[model samples]
Target: MSYFRSVALGAAMSLAGVAGAAAQEVQERTMTLGHVVAEQFPYHTSAMFMKEKMAEETDGKWTLEVHPSGAMGGERDALDALLLGTMDFTWVHTAAMASFVPSFELFNMPFVFHSPEHIEEALSTLDFSKFYEEADAAGFKLIGIGSPAFRYPMNNIRPIETAADFEDIKMRTMGVSAHIDTYEALGSQVASTSFAELYGALQTGTVDGNENALSALNAMRFNEVQEYLTLLPTVANIAVLVMSKSTYDAMSAEEQALVDEIGKQTVEKNNSDYASMDAEALEAMKQEGLKVNEIDDLSSFVEATAPVREKYSQDLEPWVRDLMAEIQELPSAK
Candidate 1:
């Protein structure tokens, strides 16, 4: 009996030693998160929230160093940096990501998502295993999906309430094929310009207008350069918080769990923050001399852009097509 008791005590001590070593393996480290948005924007504010939460969850062992305002570069550049291991994480909208993952073009399909709430519902309930597999193939891990709002046409030249309003209007797009095709379908002359140079382009009349989520437009102060904001929900602006797969793989399982948890929380924080910001920004912009209008006849614009959707859907995989159909069928605020 004494020999059995002695053996059990030694086994327990060995297990404790192993557990201590495992805990010691989790070293204090800070990861970098980058995005091309103003500091006051939800992208930055939510990142800061993640930063604080990460440190608390890890007991100060893990933290984040966030860079905003294009300090790291545009969305594409940031994605490249992640692939090259220079950036650990980045927040990028689906439109910018479509070039890297062709299937992502589904998210950029014109008029697919009716409203921001519809997007949120679709993302939360969708089976995205295939999307994640593609992202892994591209050497990145999608940590979270955030739909702050829908993109709308904002211009300096005139109010756009119908497809006719887009005629001969020069519009700047992210150079995504779908976006370019959509604007062309609507009869707008599409101009390709880097997002960093968009403000200057709008100010100099190089481009008459552009479309973006209200949060981004407000944060960039597009109202200062543009005259009208038409509340036509053109597309759901789906922002993904992504991390380098290599970086995520390097972390201990426990640390990865912490990062994943915080990434998800950041999404909720962003959604809440954006709702407040959008309402306040709209009211403030109106008082500051920005003309805002709502589309009375959305069917005309939808009909004009239908070709853009059909053109892109021709090459989609079966699963992607099925998912797209389901998302479109989701209930919308509109």
Candidate 2:
């Protein structure tokens, strides 16, 4: 009887140990994701997707609460909060990220990425290790790269078919140096406007024009304030989904893996959805009475902006410079 009792007790202890270890593999917590875009935009849509999938995948062990439309402040403020471990996640425009991680300036250069298909290819094939390293050093862990569409000029002024059309046109741009310099180089006076304040500025005529993806233009109701959208494809509006390094560090290995998996899925969904959204939004805007024009001869605009590209790329790290060349060389399709 004593021998039987000893074996039973040993087995009970081992079973308890296994159960405790398994329990520790996933920690329960509610995380927050914040961005400065309308709920109808890709940024918010992706966040909500992430939130739902994370909850299902983790079996309620983790919850993601999303805040949209500057509830957590602008892009810079959200990034700062992430570094201080106050915010868990955010998806910011690559131009805005240049200030936080200088290497991101490589993405802000004009015509570096030819189209959405080209960007998708470059992101999958190019070496982003250097970018990831720089972001890590800046307290951000980049989990995914996504883009809606190339940016085009939108303004109440006449359609910008030629380089000369930009002359004397006041334009609003994010306060990034690369964007500001590029617009100024093209002969347009630039206003460094907060994105949240941009619609009001346009409505009040504080600026004559701005540039953004068609989906964004529609989502923000730019059609109500601006009359035309010129399809110039000046630069790719890349969006990066990042998590707080400290928050990542505090997660269990299993939990971290779960986050990574969900992050990739979220961006893949956003990118696929953007293709359709861009088309649908364009038609929606047209029906709303917004004039749209396409420029087949981007040669004039490209030539004018060539100097701006050269100026920005001149000082990039060798790896980034090499990556830029590789990306530009990739086929526009496939």
Each prediction's RMSD to truth: 12.5, 13.2
Model 2 residue 163 lDDT?
Answer: 85
What is the Å distance of residue 117 in model 1 from its true position? Answer: 1.5
Per model, how many backbone clashes are there? 0, 0
lDDT of 1: 0.79
lDDT of 1 by residue, 12-34 (tens): 21111112223455678878999
Clashing pairs in 2: none
Give the Å error, residue 160, model 1: 2.7
**Candidate 1 ranges with C-alpha deviation above 4 Å:** 1-25, 156-158, 193-206
lDDT of 2 by residue, 1-334 (tens): 2222232234221111111223457778899999998788778887898888776666677789999988999898999999999999999999778889988988888777655667768888878888888999888988887864687789888888988888888998756677777788788999877887999999999989998877878888988999988877677788889999999989877777777878877887676556656777777888999988876676676778888888887887888888888887788631
Model 2 TM-score relative to the real fold = 0.85
lDDT of each: 0.79, 0.80
